[model samples]
Target: MKIYETAGFPNPARIRMALAEKNASDAVTFVPVDVMAGEHRSEAFRAKNPDATVPYLELADGTCIAQCTAITEYIDGSFDGPSLTGRSPFARAHISMMNLRAENGLLNAVADYFHHATPGLGPDLETDQCAEWGEKRKAVATKTMSYLDGVLAESPYVAGDAFSVADITVFAGLAFADFAKVDIAEELTHLHAWRARVAERPSVAN
Candidate 1:
Protein backbone atom coordinates (compact mmCIF):
# COMPACT_ATOMS: atom_id res chain seq x y z
CA MET A 1 0.00 0.00 0.00
CA LYS A 2 1.02 3.57 -0.67
CA ILE A 3 0.05 6.50 1.56
CA TYR A 4 0.17 10.06 0.27
CA GLU A 5 1.23 12.17 3.22
CA THR A 6 2.21 15.71 4.19
CA ALA A 7 4.57 16.70 6.97
CA GLY A 8 2.42 19.33 8.68
CA PHE A 9 -1.09 18.04 7.99
CA PRO A 10 -3.24 16.61 10.82
CA ASN A 11 -5.18 13.96 8.88
CA PRO A 12 -2.13 12.11 7.62
CA ALA A 13 -0.60 12.14 11.08
CA ARG A 14 -3.65 10.29 12.41
CA ILE A 15 -3.16 7.49 9.92
CA ARG A 16 0.56 7.34 10.57
CA MET A 17 -0.02 7.03 14.29
CA ALA A 18 -2.50 4.24 13.68
CA LEU A 19 0.05 2.47 11.53
CA ALA A 20 2.57 2.67 14.32
CA GLU A 21 0.09 1.51 16.96
CA LYS A 22 -0.93 -1.50 14.86
CA ASN A 23 2.68 -2.41 13.94
CA ALA A 24 1.75 -2.05 10.25
CA SER A 25 4.14 0.76 9.41
CA ASP A 26 6.55 -1.46 7.51
CA ALA A 27 3.89 -2.76 5.15
CA VAL A 28 3.23 0.53 3.38
CA THR A 29 5.12 3.07 1.32
CA PHE A 30 4.98 6.78 2.15
CA VAL A 31 4.42 9.37 -0.57
CA PRO A 32 4.76 12.99 0.43
CA VAL A 33 2.37 15.52 -1.12
CA ASP A 34 3.39 19.16 -1.01
CA VAL A 35 0.34 21.10 0.19
CA MET A 36 2.02 24.49 -0.11
CA ALA A 37 2.63 23.99 -3.80
CA GLY A 38 -1.03 23.06 -4.43
CA GLU A 39 -0.03 19.62 -5.63
CA HIS A 40 -3.24 18.20 -4.23
CA ARG A 41 -5.26 20.37 -6.60
CA SER A 42 -3.65 18.85 -9.65
CA GLU A 43 -5.59 16.60 -12.01
CA ALA A 44 -3.60 13.51 -11.04
CA PHE A 45 -4.45 13.86 -7.37
CA ARG A 46 -8.07 14.86 -8.00
CA ALA A 47 -8.50 11.62 -9.90
CA LYS A 48 -7.52 9.77 -6.74
CA ASN A 49 -9.59 11.93 -4.39
CA PRO A 50 -12.27 14.19 -5.77
CA ASP A 51 -12.25 16.12 -2.52
CA ALA A 52 -8.71 17.24 -3.34
CA THR A 53 -7.37 16.45 0.09
CA VAL A 54 -4.09 14.98 1.21
CA PRO A 55 -3.45 11.78 3.22
CA TYR A 56 -4.57 9.48 0.41
CA LEU A 57 -3.97 5.73 0.53
CA GLU A 58 -3.52 3.60 -2.57
CA LEU A 59 -4.15 -0.10 -2.11
CA ALA A 60 -1.88 -2.62 -3.81
CA ASP A 61 -4.48 -3.28 -6.49
CA GLY A 62 -4.61 0.51 -7.17
CA THR A 63 -7.73 1.42 -5.20
CA CYS A 64 -7.60 4.72 -3.34
CA ILE A 65 -8.87 5.56 0.14
CA ALA A 66 -9.42 9.13 1.31
CA GLN A 67 -10.26 10.55 4.72
CA CYS A 68 -8.06 9.85 7.76
CA THR A 69 -10.66 8.09 9.89
CA ALA A 70 -11.63 5.59 7.20
CA ILE A 71 -8.02 4.79 6.40
CA THR A 72 -7.11 4.33 10.07
CA GLU A 73 -10.03 2.00 10.73
CA TYR A 74 -9.19 -0.02 7.63
CA ILE A 75 -5.59 -0.40 8.74
CA ASP A 76 -6.58 -1.38 12.26
CA GLY A 77 -9.07 -3.94 10.99
CA SER A 78 -6.57 -5.48 8.58
CA PHE A 79 -3.81 -5.86 11.18
CA ASP A 80 -3.65 -8.21 14.18
CA GLY A 81 -1.12 -6.59 16.50
CA PRO A 82 -2.46 -4.39 19.32
CA SER A 83 -5.83 -3.15 18.11
CA LEU A 84 -6.24 0.61 17.98
CA THR A 85 -9.92 0.05 18.70
CA GLY A 86 -10.69 -1.22 22.19
CA ARG A 87 -10.60 -4.96 22.98
CA SER A 88 -14.14 -5.25 24.37
CA PRO A 89 -17.44 -4.26 22.75
CA PHE A 90 -18.15 -1.57 25.31
CA ALA A 91 -14.65 -0.19 24.97
CA ARG A 92 -15.05 -0.06 21.19
CA ALA A 93 -18.31 1.87 21.48
CA HIS A 94 -16.79 4.31 23.94
CA ILE A 95 -13.74 4.95 21.78
CA SER A 96 -15.90 5.41 18.69
CA MET A 97 -18.12 7.92 20.46
CA MET A 98 -15.16 9.82 21.86
CA ASN A 99 -13.49 9.86 18.48
CA LEU A 100 -16.54 11.45 16.87
CA ARG A 101 -16.76 14.01 19.64
CA ALA A 102 -13.14 14.99 19.16
CA GLU A 103 -13.57 15.25 15.42
CA ASN A 104 -16.72 17.35 15.54
CA GLY A 105 -15.89 19.44 18.59
CA LEU A 106 -12.21 20.07 17.94
CA LEU A 107 -10.90 19.04 14.54
CA ASN A 108 -13.65 20.40 12.31
CA ALA A 109 -13.89 23.60 14.32
CA VAL A 110 -10.16 24.19 13.97
CA ALA A 111 -10.38 23.61 10.24
CA ASP A 112 -13.14 26.19 9.91
CA TYR A 113 -11.10 28.72 11.86
CA PHE A 114 -7.95 27.96 9.98
CA HIS A 115 -9.44 28.07 6.51
CA HIS A 116 -11.85 30.95 6.88
CA ALA A 117 -10.21 33.18 9.48
CA THR A 118 -6.51 32.72 8.83
CA PRO A 119 -4.61 33.07 5.56
CA GLY A 120 -4.96 29.40 4.79
CA LEU A 121 -3.40 27.58 1.80
CA GLY A 122 -1.91 30.87 0.58
CA PRO A 123 -5.33 32.50 0.12
CA ASP A 124 -6.15 35.82 1.73
CA LEU A 125 -8.61 35.45 4.59
CA GLU A 126 -11.87 37.39 4.85
CA THR A 127 -12.97 40.19 7.19
CA ASP A 128 -13.34 40.68 10.95
CA GLN A 129 -16.38 38.38 10.96
CA CYS A 130 -14.12 35.54 10.01
CA ALA A 131 -11.86 36.28 12.91
CA GLU A 132 -14.87 36.41 15.22
CA TRP A 133 -15.96 33.03 13.97
CA GLY A 134 -12.48 31.75 14.65
CA GLU A 135 -12.62 32.98 18.22
CA LYS A 136 -15.88 31.13 18.68
CA ARG A 137 -14.37 27.98 17.21
CA LYS A 138 -11.36 28.23 19.47
CA ALA A 139 -13.59 28.56 22.48
CA VAL A 140 -15.59 25.51 21.55
CA ALA A 141 -12.48 23.48 20.88
CA THR A 142 -10.79 24.48 24.16
CA LYS A 143 -13.86 23.74 26.21
CA THR A 144 -14.08 20.27 24.72
CA MET A 145 -10.40 19.79 25.34
CA SER A 146 -10.86 20.74 28.96
CA TYR A 147 -13.59 18.14 29.34
CA LEU A 148 -11.38 15.53 27.70
CA ASP A 149 -8.56 16.54 29.99
CA GLY A 150 -10.76 15.85 32.99
CA VAL A 151 -11.56 12.44 31.53
CA LEU A 152 -7.89 11.76 30.87
CA ALA A 153 -7.11 12.66 34.47
CA GLU A 154 -9.34 9.80 35.55
CA SER A 155 -8.29 7.31 32.86
CA PRO A 156 -4.97 6.65 31.16
CA TYR A 157 -6.42 7.26 27.68
CA VAL A 158 -9.25 9.30 26.17
CA ALA A 159 -11.68 6.40 25.58
CA GLY A 160 -10.78 4.43 28.70
CA ASP A 161 -7.76 2.85 30.40
CA ALA A 162 -6.49 1.56 27.03
CA PHE A 163 -4.77 3.50 24.30
CA SER A 164 -7.07 3.39 21.31
CA VAL A 165 -8.07 5.21 18.10
CA ALA A 166 -9.79 7.91 20.15
CA ASP A 167 -6.46 9.10 21.48
CA ILE A 168 -4.78 9.16 18.07
CA THR A 169 -7.68 10.98 16.38
CA VAL A 170 -7.79 13.66 19.04
CA PHE A 171 -4.02 13.98 19.15
CA ALA A 172 -3.77 14.63 15.42
CA GLY A 173 -6.22 17.52 15.61
CA LEU A 174 -4.64 18.99 18.77
CA ALA A 175 -1.13 18.83 17.33
CA PHE A 176 -2.30 20.68 14.23
CA ALA A 177 -3.91 23.33 16.41
CA ASP A 178 -0.57 23.78 18.17
CA PHE A 179 1.11 24.29 14.80
CA ALA A 180 -1.51 26.91 13.94
CA LYS A 181 -0.81 28.77 17.21
CA VAL A 182 -3.99 27.91 19.07
CA ASP A 183 -3.41 28.02 22.83
CA ILE A 184 -4.82 25.67 25.43
CA ALA A 185 -5.53 26.85 28.96
CA GLU A 186 -2.85 26.20 31.61
CA GLU A 187 -5.48 24.68 33.87
CA LEU A 188 -5.77 21.65 31.60
CA THR A 189 -2.74 19.92 33.04
CA HIS A 190 -3.96 16.43 32.33
CA LEU A 191 -4.20 17.12 28.62
CA HIS A 192 -0.74 18.62 28.60
CA ALA A 193 0.66 15.47 30.20
CA TRP A 194 -1.25 13.23 27.81
CA ARG A 195 0.08 15.20 24.83
CA ALA A 196 3.61 14.61 25.99
CA ARG A 197 2.98 10.88 26.36
CA VAL A 198 1.56 10.63 22.83
CA ALA A 199 4.50 12.58 21.43
CA GLU A 200 6.93 10.08 22.89
CA ARG A 201 5.68 7.50 20.39
CA PRO A 202 7.98 6.85 17.40
CA SER A 203 5.28 7.60 14.78
CA VAL A 204 4.72 11.13 16.15
CA ALA A 205 8.43 11.87 15.68
CA ASN A 206 8.27 10.91 12.03
Candidate 2:
Protein backbone atom coordinates (compact mmCIF):
# COMPACT_ATOMS: atom_id res chain seq x y z
CA MET A 1 0.00 0.00 0.00
CA LYS A 2 1.03 3.59 -0.62
CA ILE A 3 -0.02 6.77 1.15
CA TYR A 4 0.16 10.08 -0.74
CA GLU A 5 0.37 13.17 1.43
CA THR A 6 2.01 16.52 1.97
CA ALA A 7 5.40 16.72 3.70
CA GLY A 8 4.39 19.18 6.34
CA PHE A 9 2.99 18.58 9.84
CA PRO A 10 -0.81 18.48 9.84
CA ASN A 11 -3.26 15.72 8.83
CA PRO A 12 -0.46 13.68 7.35
CA ALA A 13 1.07 13.60 10.82
CA ARG A 14 -2.18 12.17 12.16
CA ILE A 15 -2.17 9.43 9.53
CA ARG A 16 1.44 8.67 10.37
CA MET A 17 0.49 8.48 14.03
CA ALA A 18 -2.30 6.04 13.27
CA LEU A 19 -0.01 3.90 11.15
CA ALA A 20 2.50 3.83 13.96
CA GLU A 21 -0.20 2.63 16.33
CA LYS A 22 -1.03 -0.21 13.96
CA ASN A 23 2.61 -0.99 13.20
CA ALA A 24 1.71 -0.41 9.59
CA SER A 25 3.95 2.52 8.74
CA ASP A 26 6.86 0.26 7.85
CA ALA A 27 4.62 -1.77 5.58
CA VAL A 28 3.31 1.06 3.41
CA THR A 29 5.18 3.42 1.11
CA PHE A 30 4.93 7.15 1.62
CA VAL A 31 4.41 9.47 -1.35
CA PRO A 32 4.86 13.12 -0.55
CA VAL A 33 2.32 15.37 -2.25
CA ASP A 34 3.21 19.05 -2.26
CA VAL A 35 0.38 21.33 -1.22
CA MET A 36 2.24 24.62 -1.13
CA ALA A 37 3.16 24.30 -4.80
CA GLY A 38 -0.45 23.39 -5.55
CA GLU A 39 0.55 19.91 -6.61
CA HIS A 40 -2.61 18.47 -5.03
CA ARG A 41 -4.67 20.87 -7.13
CA SER A 42 -3.03 19.52 -10.26
CA GLU A 43 -4.94 17.25 -12.63
CA ALA A 44 -2.81 14.25 -11.74
CA PHE A 45 -3.54 14.59 -8.05
CA ARG A 46 -7.23 15.25 -8.69
CA ALA A 47 -7.38 12.02 -10.66
CA LYS A 48 -6.60 10.29 -7.37
CA ASN A 49 -8.82 12.50 -5.23
CA PRO A 50 -11.40 14.80 -6.73
CA ASP A 51 -11.43 16.83 -3.52
CA ALA A 52 -7.71 17.57 -3.89
CA THR A 53 -6.94 16.73 -0.28
CA VAL A 54 -3.87 15.36 1.38
CA PRO A 55 -3.42 11.99 3.19
CA TYR A 56 -4.85 9.86 0.41
CA LEU A 57 -4.17 6.12 0.46
CA GLU A 58 -3.64 3.96 -2.61
CA LEU A 59 -3.96 0.22 -2.20
CA ALA A 60 -1.51 -2.17 -3.85
CA ASP A 61 -3.92 -2.98 -6.66
CA GLY A 62 -4.45 0.78 -7.33
CA THR A 63 -7.55 1.70 -5.32
CA CYS A 64 -7.38 5.22 -3.91
CA ILE A 65 -9.05 6.15 -0.65
CA ALA A 66 -9.72 9.80 0.19
CA GLN A 67 -10.64 11.43 3.50
CA CYS A 68 -8.86 10.80 6.79
CA THR A 69 -11.85 9.06 8.38
CA ALA A 70 -12.19 6.52 5.59
CA ILE A 71 -8.48 5.80 5.45
CA THR A 72 -8.20 5.43 9.21
CA GLU A 73 -11.22 3.15 9.36
CA TYR A 74 -9.77 0.95 6.65
CA ILE A 75 -6.48 0.63 8.49
CA ASP A 76 -8.21 -0.09 11.78
CA GLY A 77 -10.26 -2.85 10.21
CA SER A 78 -7.46 -4.39 8.16
CA PHE A 79 -4.74 -4.52 10.81
CA ASP A 80 -4.69 -6.91 13.76
CA GLY A 81 -3.13 -5.19 16.71
CA PRO A 82 -5.43 -3.36 19.09
CA SER A 83 -8.85 -2.50 17.67
CA LEU A 84 -9.17 1.26 17.63
CA THR A 85 -12.81 1.48 16.61
CA GLY A 86 -14.21 -1.19 18.92
CA ARG A 87 -15.12 -4.86 19.05
CA SER A 88 -18.84 -4.40 19.65
CA PRO A 89 -21.74 -2.79 17.82
CA PHE A 90 -22.48 -0.38 20.65
CA ALA A 91 -18.87 0.60 20.89
CA ARG A 92 -18.67 1.22 17.17
CA ALA A 93 -21.75 3.42 17.20
CA HIS A 94 -20.54 5.41 20.18
CA ILE A 95 -17.08 5.84 18.76
CA SER A 96 -18.48 6.93 15.43
CA MET A 97 -20.76 9.44 17.15
CA MET A 98 -17.92 10.96 19.11
CA ASN A 99 -15.74 11.13 16.03
CA LEU A 100 -18.42 12.89 14.03
CA ARG A 101 -19.12 15.34 16.83
CA ALA A 102 -15.46 16.26 17.15
CA GLU A 103 -14.95 16.61 13.41
CA ASN A 104 -17.98 18.80 12.77
CA GLY A 105 -18.15 20.61 16.09
CA LEU A 106 -14.51 21.24 16.88
CA LEU A 107 -12.22 20.35 13.99
CA ASN A 108 -14.09 22.13 11.25
CA ALA A 109 -14.43 25.25 13.36
CA VAL A 110 -10.72 25.25 14.13
CA ALA A 111 -9.92 24.90 10.42
CA ASP A 112 -12.29 27.72 9.63
CA TYR A 113 -10.40 29.89 12.09
CA PHE A 114 -6.89 28.90 11.09
CA HIS A 115 -6.74 27.84 7.43
CA HIS A 116 -9.33 30.34 6.30
CA ALA A 117 -8.08 33.22 8.41
CA THR A 118 -4.34 32.79 8.11
CA PRO A 119 -2.56 34.48 5.23
CA GLY A 120 0.06 31.91 4.32
CA LEU A 121 -2.37 29.50 2.67
CA GLY A 122 -3.59 30.76 -0.76
CA PRO A 123 -7.22 31.82 -0.46
CA ASP A 124 -6.63 33.30 2.96
CA LEU A 125 -4.10 35.69 1.42
CA GLU A 126 -6.65 37.13 -0.98
CA THR A 127 -9.34 38.46 1.33
CA ASP A 128 -10.49 39.58 4.77
CA GLN A 129 -13.76 37.65 4.72
CA CYS A 130 -11.94 34.51 5.78
CA ALA A 131 -10.51 36.36 8.74
CA GLU A 132 -13.95 37.63 9.59
CA TRP A 133 -15.42 34.13 9.33
CA GLY A 134 -12.60 32.73 11.38
CA GLU A 135 -13.27 35.14 14.19
CA LYS A 136 -16.95 34.27 14.09
CA ARG A 137 -16.31 30.50 13.99
CA LYS A 138 -14.05 30.74 17.04
CA ALA A 139 -17.01 31.00 19.36
CA VAL A 140 -18.45 27.71 18.15
CA ALA A 141 -15.08 26.04 18.62
CA THR A 142 -14.89 27.27 22.20
CA LYS A 143 -18.27 25.77 22.98
CA THR A 144 -17.31 22.48 21.42
CA MET A 145 -14.08 22.34 23.38
CA SER A 146 -15.83 22.98 26.63
CA TYR A 147 -18.32 20.22 25.90
CA LEU A 148 -15.57 17.76 25.02
CA ASP A 149 -13.62 18.72 28.11
CA GLY A 150 -16.61 17.86 30.20
CA VAL A 151 -17.00 14.57 28.39
CA LEU A 152 -13.35 13.74 28.88
CA ALA A 153 -13.65 14.56 32.56
CA GLU A 154 -16.33 11.90 32.92
CA SER A 155 -14.83 9.26 30.63
CA PRO A 156 -11.19 8.23 30.24
CA TYR A 157 -11.51 8.44 26.46
CA VAL A 158 -13.82 10.31 24.12
CA ALA A 159 -16.37 7.47 23.99
CA GLY A 160 -15.53 5.67 27.23
CA ASP A 161 -12.72 4.17 29.31
CA ALA A 162 -11.31 2.24 26.37
CA PHE A 163 -9.22 4.13 23.85
CA SER A 164 -11.11 3.96 20.58
CA VAL A 165 -10.97 5.42 17.08
CA ALA A 166 -12.94 8.38 18.38
CA ASP A 167 -10.02 9.22 20.63
CA ILE A 168 -7.66 9.32 17.64
CA THR A 169 -10.01 11.48 15.63
CA VAL A 170 -10.50 13.96 18.45
CA PHE A 171 -6.85 13.95 19.35
CA ALA A 172 -5.80 14.69 15.77
CA GLY A 173 -8.31 17.51 15.50
CA LEU A 174 -7.26 19.06 18.80
CA ALA A 175 -3.62 18.75 17.79
CA PHE A 176 -4.52 20.84 14.77
CA ALA A 177 -6.30 23.26 17.07
CA ASP A 178 -3.15 23.59 19.17
CA PHE A 179 -1.12 24.44 16.08
CA ALA A 180 -3.63 27.17 15.27
CA LYS A 181 -3.18 28.73 18.71
CA VAL A 182 -6.71 27.96 19.73
CA ASP A 183 -6.34 27.64 23.44
CA ILE A 184 -8.40 25.26 25.50
CA ALA A 185 -9.56 26.79 28.75
CA GLU A 186 -7.28 26.34 31.75
CA GLU A 187 -10.34 25.15 33.63
CA LEU A 188 -10.48 22.05 31.42
CA THR A 189 -8.25 20.07 33.73
CA HIS A 190 -9.38 16.64 32.58
CA LEU A 191 -8.88 17.48 28.93
CA HIS A 192 -5.45 18.92 29.66
CA ALA A 193 -4.47 15.69 31.38
CA TRP A 194 -5.97 13.58 28.62
CA ARG A 195 -4.06 15.57 26.03
CA ALA A 196 -0.89 14.90 27.94
CA ARG A 197 -1.63 11.18 28.01
CA VAL A 198 -2.31 11.05 24.30
CA ALA A 199 0.84 12.97 23.57
CA GLU A 200 2.84 10.58 25.69
CA ARG A 201 1.73 7.62 23.58
CA PRO A 202 4.48 6.29 21.31
CA SER A 203 2.19 6.35 18.34
CA VAL A 204 1.36 10.02 18.86
CA ALA A 205 4.99 11.04 19.39
CA ASN A 206 6.11 8.99 16.40
Error of 2 at 138 (Å): 1.7
Q: For model 2, how does the per-residue alpha-carbon lDDT over 142-162 read when each residue is reduced to its tens digit?
A: 888899999988898899988
lDDT of 1 by residue, 1-206 (tens): 99998876888878878998877899999999877777888899999988888798999898999987778878988998877776678877888899999898888777767776677665522334477787788777878888889898999888887788888978977876887677777889999899899888776766
Q: Which residue pairs in model 1 clash with each other?
A: none
Question: Residue 63, candidate 2: how far off, in angstroms?
Answer: 0.8
Query: Against the correct fold, how does model 2 do in TM-score?
Result: 0.92
Candidate 1 accuracy as TM-score: 0.89
lDDT scores in order: 0.82, 0.81
Can you tell me which runs of candidate 1 are displaced by over 4 Å?
124-129
* Worst lDDT 10-window in candidate 2: 120-129
